[model samples]
Target: MKKIHHAEASSYFIEAKDNEAFHDQRLWDLRQKRDREAAVIPEFQELRNLASQIKEHTLTHLAEYLEQFEAKAQANGVTVHWALDAAEHNRIVYDLLTDHSVRTLVKSKSMLTEECELRPFLERRGIEVIETDLGERIQQLDNEPPSHIVVPAVHKLRGDVAKVFARTLDTDPDNDDPNYLSEQMRVKTRHFFVDAEAGMTGGNFAVAETGGVVVCTNEGNADLSANVPPLFIASVGIEKLVPRLDDLAVFIRLLSRSALGSPITQYTSHFRAPRKSGEMHIILVDNGRSERLGMEEFWYSLKCIRCGACMNTCPVYRRSGGLSYGAVYSGPIGIILNPTHDMRKYSSLPFASTLNGSCTHVCPVKINIHEQIYGWRRVLAKHNQLPFVKKAAMKVAGKILSDPQKYRKTIDVADAAIEHLPRFLLYSRMNAWGRQREVPAPPDQTFHAWYLKNREGKQ
Candidate 1:
């Protein structure tokens, strides 16, 4: 597939003014909710700082903790698997299902599985992989990717959801009621719970000290998926591991409040091992995380807890929509992560941000997201990865900026053009900034000119 840059994709998103405004309002509501929730916690900033410190300590000593977790989990009868990359992770999961003769699998919300493209991977081989989470199931039925990590269908309206349900599951065509749709999905999802032979979930936190995979969900889908099936599998990023149960406590306090504006998620389940007779497996995926770790300036990106708070508060993300980034993850965090995961395909992501730093301010782990994005821009420029047009523009700009005479002459010409040219000419497609917005009115005179006139004789 040919890849389009964020700018081009977002242009299409911007065309939907109503949808864009609605999307912006919805995400901003979540941000406001987060702020309200945070206000009640007297030690919120302290909690975030503690979480950051714990993550840093754990990541630096990650290998030791992984070894410890593996040993403890096995002792608790939970089988552990390590995957060096996405292919390995998918293959490991497929092999497990095949070995157990599992023809049908039920899954909860798992961004890692989405990242690995697990549903299509298993489905291609005749395994009936079902997404049980309401938003995920809706997207799965519609054959679309998640628009937001926490709220998967935030880009969609209730009518769009009703239409999808009506078409795919044969629900009432006229009813767009939220409760009606949710009930229909609930009744339909229960069938997957009963028929599926295996279940899979994504980990919110992996407690290395106790070898438990913690999953937080509002819908209780993760619990249902894990308990009803005879086989359970969890796919977790390497970054999800924490040093101890106490560290997990710190994150648990921040995750839901930041992501959903709740004190805590409704169901925070911990799976250490399978029930009496069932089997449990944990697949720890690297998927370029180790490589990302080696980038000293950007290693802190791994501390993210997938809370999605940064996206909620991001001005650019609010307007652009998640699909604009063209990656599994989106928003300020995605701008840093996607390029680090694969720079060739995602090199345009860093340019998606406005560098307002609101993302960094709202991050539960304090990842310095905006700064990392700025750093990635330098990396891209260093490797000549920038577009030819942008490079040429920068070179010309640099030349003009280096000489005062050239700068003054250019400013004078621009001022004259702005003052004399017709709007149609000045705001045409040739002028990139003017294409989206009206050209700024020309200043009465250049700042330099005014300064020279007003201050030259002051002494």
Candidate 2:
């Protein structure tokens, strides 16, 4: 799949506007259902808090926890490998395949694998990798990045998918029924499962105490992927750890409800060791996450369960679309993660939001996303990476606001100009706000004028 560049991602948002209103209405309906399901749970907030605290505490002592996890995993007859970065992670997996003489692999949904671009890397080494998830399969055919974390092809319509499947799977384009297309895909994918030598999956939560890797999926694709293949490889970020097995319930409760409006995903498989004498491999990937963990303001982002609730609830995300963020993860989480990888590449993300606080409110983990965006602004300014025009404007504004005389003069001039302000000046390229809204004309009388008139002899 061609990696969608930032410009292309931004273009998706512009293109989406030309579509009918029904698309947005559908999203609104889905979002409302998600919210309603979340609201019915009386202990949702408490669960979020507990989950946050558990993650925070776990991360603080990550080194010890990781060591414990590795020990338990090895004890359970699983071979564990540590990768310092994406490149290392890919090479390790590829080497394992080469060592085993594996030719093909079937994989469940694993963002970490996507982050490492594992499939492409393996393919480059002459090993074919097939994505098992339906959404992922759609994206694979489209040659595009996953638009939504949970729903990889969420941006695609049934027609879009039908076109892709017709071209890739040779399905009949006349039959656009989802069930037919799904059955066709099932038949095609079944071959890969039977022939593939390895199964790859992403870990939702890795139990530190027992070395268990828990994978949640609605389609049971992960189980099929793991069970069908003799070699099961599970890749997870180091932060996806909890102290014990019972802790899984709290996260499981919040994850599916926030992700797809389900109380729980249909399938949650826990793999502590290989099945039927199959070899199990666990790869713990750092991939700049260790650096992100060190930054206090942005560290809370690690607590994300990849449920994508933050994106679904964000007004900006709804309008701009996931592609605009220009990262593997989009929406509120992407805004923070994008900058961490390459601040210059995603410089526009933090400022793209209205700071409305909706993303933070909906986050399953109580991450203060809005405040972190502000912090990123400060960091960018400190690094002198802010755009020159914005910096200069802020400087001038600060100078005027700091000087009472200049401020009063500017206010009076602004009040005078309002009577004759041009529509374009108030509604042009200077800001997007004016494009969608009519800027209220300044009050005819300044507050100082009104105060003096109303306070005859009060002072």
Candidate 3:
């Protein structure tokens, strides 16, 4: 896959904002209602705490839970595979399809697969893979990465999709009605449901106690994908594990409401095993998750339900847009996860956030997102990722702030500089603060200066 530069990414970010505002406004209204209801519910906060604890405990003993999950799944007639990273995960899935001589695959929306670039990998191997999720399918045809995990094509307008469908499916471009477009997509995608030899999905939650994989989808594509094909594969991150089936009630209740403001998704299917006569495969992908868990301060990010509530509430995310993060996972969760995978590859992600703490507040499982970003900055700095100018500036500031005499002198200089600063200098590209808003001019004198002149003699 070709990597997008920050400048190119920003252009897409601008497009995403214009395309998503309507849906975003609707989601915001629903989110306010959900927030009000959650506040009134006496147990909501307690449940969040419990969920956090459960996730912490589960992650601490991930090796054990994974072992138990794999054993039980295999015993229940499900084939389990493990991949150390994204390449291995993609290869494992591709090999399974090749062995079965399956050429076409119908997939439900799976960010895990997207992270691994599964569709492109398969297409390179001469297999046709169709994304059945409406949003995903739109992005697939557009040849763009999903801007948002839940709303894959949130960056695309109805007209944008209509254009793509017109080109790909030979539909009329003049008809941009969502209903007409959806019906056309339904007709185009229905053939894959019957003719495709394999169906793939991402696991929402894997129950360690029962070895069942639960998938939540509003479109019902996951259920259709799982049942229609003789060979079914579920690709999931290793962190998506709950201890038992009962725990799903808490997560399910929180997930949809947080994600799209729905009371519940239209479909929530649990696959205990495959079809009685067909094959079922589960690929447990680590892909740097274990490394992330090793970092105590950042480990809580594993608890994310991919609800995207955090993204919606996040001020930085709202303004900068999802593509600014430069990862498959975006918003608060992406900031932590992206750096863990490859800091050099995602060095820009953590710094992109404003550390506003809104993501942490909206998180269903209460992951401390802002703190993790702070921790990442420390880690990045320790590793010498800071720019030379910033390092020099910080070193000077630190030395001055640490000494009273130096600090007093620095303040005097700052007062003089503020008074004399030119407009061009204040608005220069070198200063990030000036990039967006104007800095206020300083007062005539410092408090220390005024106090000494006016009150020292009186005292």
Measured over all alpha carbons after superposition, the RMSD of each candidate to the real structure, in angstroms, is 2.5, 3.0, 2.8
Question: After best superposition, candidate 2 residue 406: deviation in angstroms?
Answer: 1.4
Candidate 2 lDDT by residue in tens digits, 157-190: 6777888999999998878899988998899999
User: Which number leads on TM-score?
Assistant: 1
- Candidate 2 TM-score over all chains jointly: 0.92
* Candidate 2 stretches greater than 4 Å from native: 1-12, 18-23, 414-416, 419-436, 452-459
Per-residue alpha-carbon lDDT of candidate 1 for residues 1-459, written as tens digits (9 for 90 to 100): 344498888988889888788899999999999999999999999999999999999899999999888888999999999999889999999999999999999999999998999899999999998898888888898999998899888888888899999999999878999999999999988988999999999999898889999999999999989999999999999889998898889999999999989999999999998899999999999998999888899999999999999999999998999988888999998899888767878888888888999999999999999999999999999988887767776787677669888767666555554644333233223467556677667767767778888998896
Clashing pairs in 2: none
Residue-wise lDDT of candidate 3 within 1-459, one digit each (tens)? 233244346556556566557545644675686687576667878778877888888888899999999989999999999999999999999999999999999999999998898888889989999999999899899888887888877656789899999999999998999999999999999999999999999999999989999999989999889899899999989999988887878888788877876678899899989897889999999988888788878888888888888877776665556766677888778888877777767766667777888888878899988889889989889998765655666776667668889667656555555643332233323356655577777777778888988999898
lDDT of 2: 0.82
The CA lDDT of each predicted structure is 0.89, 0.82, 0.82
- Best lDDT goes to which candidate? 1
Count clashing pairs, candidate 1. 0
Per-prediction TM-score, please?
Answer: 0.95, 0.92, 0.92
Question: What is candidate 2's CA lDDT for residue 35?
Answer: 88
Q: Count of backbone clashes for each model?
A: 0, 0, 0
